[model samples]
Target: MGAPVSVTCLSAPVSVTCLSAPVSVTCLSAPVSVTCLSAPVSVTCLSAPVSVTCLSAPVSVTCLSAPVSVTCLSAPVSVTCLSAPVSVTCLSAPVSVTCLSALVSVTCLSAPVSVTRLSAPVSVTRLSAPVSVTCFSAPVSVTCLSAPVSVTCLSAPVSVTCFSAPVSVTCLSAPVSVTCLSAPVSVTCFSAPVSVTRLSAPVSVTCLSAPVSVTCFSAPVSVTCLSALVSVTCLSAPVSVTCLSAPVSVKCLSAPVSVTCLSAPVSVTCFSAPVSVTCLSAPVSVTCLSAPVSVTCLSAPVSVTCFSAPVSVTCFSAPVSVTRLSAPVSVTCLSAPSLSDVSLSPSVSDVIISLEVLASLGMDIQPG
Candidate 1:
């Protein structure tokens, strides 16, 4: 309403772009981008990337160091990435990102953008509109084609593609791909090949210095890796995964799932149900449907199942088997040669088996 205020900022090897009608703008410490179109906008990207874009609306955006990628279209969105690699994309909206030596990318369309140190390369692209792209590293390329997008790459190479729903990608030293269909999607990859494709709503995939893969079709999907060779896939569901070692796989379809693999070689599968699986050593597997199941294994192989009820199975040492049928079941097996077969229908029971207790009861339990 006051003849559209215009401001430009600079911080050496940093770029700040501001266009169209503006109300107020400021950039401190590093290079930043701000675009205000016939509205009042305030943006601060401290150590992260905070981008705010609004049409005839007031917006405020801020970001810290947490690898937080939030993409909101047609409104105001706030995000923070703290000491981690995170990406956020918003079309006609507001988004933020923060990093400490972490990879990050933030993109906005017809909105105000603020990006900080980044430490990695930052790219923003667009067409027939105001598009801003900035890179902060040597030998880094920032590319934006058709409709104002932002892409950031690290010491290596990073690529991103978005159509209609605003996509964001951040890579520390690996490759990440995100495909969004009518929703906000964020994909962050660190030293691995991570792919998130074909979703109907908000979903996030994160990989950290591990060989990991995650795929989601709908709902909220989250995959975080601190290990090697981890895989997760979900369709119209929420999948939470945490890995600390090699070879962990999780698959879910229209269900609520939680998996934590601290050791190696763990697998889980679920359909239209809730399942919780935790593996401590090598080799643990869980497959369930329409029930609440928990399987915990330490230093050996273990298997468990529950249908229409609650089940918990814990194992220690080698070659232990515990099976329960149709009830509230609990099996605690320690130091095999021990086997338990329980069938307690519609009741509450606890069965404890130890090799030392079996030997005390005049039964010979061989320890292999």
Candidate 2:
């Protein structure tokens, strides 16, 4: 141990207490710091405004409230923070990433993963229904439709689909319609939707022969004549005919009117202006009342025979008028008419008579 030393200075008197050689001591002006060259040593300070600095070959220095640097020769390298203020950095592998409050399962282990949402249920229709669906993107679009409905569209996608309800197809142009009574509607491709024009019928009718005149009729329109039959093709389209329900025109030729009895060619006794007789089918026979050597028959074969001569006969409007010629005028057996008149006027009064006969087997003569 070193002895105590006293030192007198102008400013103050100081004393030093040292325990060993090469130790540090101080007065009121300086802080008392103790150092040892050998082993461990301890020192205490009892005054304020004191400062101490330590340096050693194998030791660390720590300053409570001053900027100081310390170096340790050898130490285990480890970093741990517990119940103290320390800054730390992480340098390790990674774990998993989780999203909160997710009902469906989703995991991102791959670059491109598919996330699917549950699709709506599809029911069965007679024609068509949604079979399946898929998502190409985050969100997907859907449509549903059925068949057999007639469709007319101005601008369409060429096709459409429906999931619910039976489809009805009709033509806006002509009277064409496609109805789905019990059959479900189908996917109507504009290329060929059930055509409204395509239909079927079960009945056919025919007439035996022509009437007094042949007439063809269509209630709504007219029919086309094929051979002797009239056929109605489309009820929707325009029906037209030349002679619809009537003859095109009645053709009648007027002949010189004259009367004839059955079989014999004799002079035709016609009254007033030349008579007009209508020539119908079949031959007519004319008979002369006065029989000469022979009866003269007219050349015209028509039922209405034209006589070359005009016989004067005055008569009034009566259904039947007959005249009885006396001995001079009558040469044959002349039948009496319903309304009979005797001979009149000249010395040989020639009575003229007219009678209507049908299908009589009597002799007829046409006058020259």
Instruction: Provide TM-scores for the models.
Output: 0.37, 0.12
Off by over 4 Å in 2: 1-126, 129-152, 157-195, 200-368
Per-residue lDDT of model 1, residues 1-368, tens digit only: 34665443444323323344444544444534444444555555445344444444445544444233444456565544446565656677544333445565656555555455445555544322333333344123333333433445564454555544455666667555555454566767678476666556566667777576656666677777776577778776778777777677888876678878777777777765677777778777666655677777777676655454466766666444444455455655555553342223333444434445456335776766
Candidates' C-alpha lDDT: 0.56, 0.23
Window of ten residues with lowest summed lDDT in model 1: 126-135
Model 2 backbone overlap count: 36
Q: What is the overall TM-score of model 2 with all chains considered together?
A: 0.12
lDDT of 2 by residue, 217-258 (tens): 111222122112222223222223221121111111121222
Error of 2 at 354 (Å): 28
Question: Cα lDDT for residue 247, model 1?
Answer: 76
- Please estimate how well model 1 matches the true structure, expressed as its whole-model Cα lDDT: 0.56
